[model samples]
Target: MRIQFMLNGSSETVDAEADTRLINVLRERYHLIGTHASCYSGECGSCIVLINGEIFHSCMTPLFRVRGMRVTTIEGFAKQHAYKEVLAGFREAGLSPCRFCAAGRILTTHALLEISPNPGEEEIAEYYRAVKCRCTDFRTYLKAVQYTGRLRRNRHRVS
Candidate 1:
């Protein structure tokens, strides 16, 4: 099957089995190593990627599912300005997630902030729960999300 999708900011096409997981195509074909493969069951958010700006587990997602859609992996997201804001928030909140869960944490933060620029405590808690990580406590995650929102809001105000 020939799947076509917008990857990062460029259009991409690859030939592979329709059932082949998106993660394999990303890592093997595109050489996008940022989207890590952990639990193939999709329980672990390590394989999360943004499809049309929404989070999806690449490991469980079939190549056909993303055809004609916009797929943004961690490497892709890292190129955008939002990545800097998220990183700054992490630094401000002293929340340095280990490499294993960094992509999930960053992408989750981006998705949450995009949905609700000023998300509440419950909303923050709800979203962060999806990414399983022991590198930081719940309170720190809350702070990071809050800080990221604040930075984004401020950036928009100045623009």
Candidate 2:
């Protein structure tokens, strides 16, 4: 099948089998290694991606399901060049031990923040729970939420 969609920010075409998984096409066919697939079972959240503004684990998602949907991977965020603050927060806190999980978490958190400007601790915890990082620790994740919150709060300060 010839798949056509917007990738990162550009329109592109991909030739893939009808039943091929999105992550496989992305990582193998397209060579977009930024979209890492860890569990390949859609439970790890390592292969999570934003497809047309909603989140989905690309590992189990089929290419046909995303034929016309816009795809956003870690590479897109890196290219758009807007992941500085949150990324730095995770970095300063040394959250890079499991780099595969970092990008998905940050992307998910960023997307959630877009909808809820000031997400409470409970909300953050709930969202973080859906993503199973290696550590299973919420302390650092909460700290990351706080860190991103500070940046968001400061950005819209009314003075």
Candidate 3:
């Protein structure tokens, strides 16, 4: 199938099979390897991507299903947060995922921040649940979210 859509922030077209998983297509064909696939199923959020501005597990999403939609991967959304800020937050919290899980974790946090710039504990749990994290428990990740929110808020107030 010939799929056309907005990737990141630009129009993109790629040839894909009807049943081809979006994760494979993105990583292999499109070469957007930043959208990692660990579980090869929706159970792991490693293959998560922003489909039409909402996070979706790409491993379960067929390319044909997202033909006309916009898909944003980690590289795109991660840029929303300063690289140093994310790295420092991860280091300070003593919770960094292995390279395989980093992309999804980063993007998940980015999406949560986009929705709730200052989410509370419950809200953070709800968002983190969707990612199905394997490295860090919700507690450490929650701290990162809180830190991210504070950073964003502080930046906003300063601006």
Residue 61, candidate 1: Cα error in Å is 0.5
Which candidate ranks first by lDDT, i.e. highest?
A: 1
- Candidate that scores best on TM-score: 1
Order the candidate numbers by TM-score, best to worst.
Answer: 1, 2, 3
Give the worst 10-residue stretch by lDDT in candidate 2.
88-97
Tens digits of lDDT, candidate 1, 1-159: 899999998999989899999999999988988888989988878889999999998999999999999999999999999999999999999999988889989999999999999999999887787778788689999999999999999999999
List the candidate 1 regions with Cα displacement exceeding 4 Å: none
Candidate 3 clashing pairs? none
Clashes of 3: 0
lDDT (Cα, 0-100) at 51 in candidate 2: 90
Model 3 agreement with the true structure over 13-89: per-residue lDDT tens digits: 87767888888888887788878778876877878898886788999998887878888887776565554566666
For candidate 2, write residues 1-159 as lDDT tens digits: 898988888898888787889998888867888678888888878888889876789998988888888999887877653477677656665565367676678777777777776788898887786578776478787777677767777867944
Q: How far is candidate 3 from the true structure (C-alpha RMSD, Å)?
A: 2.1
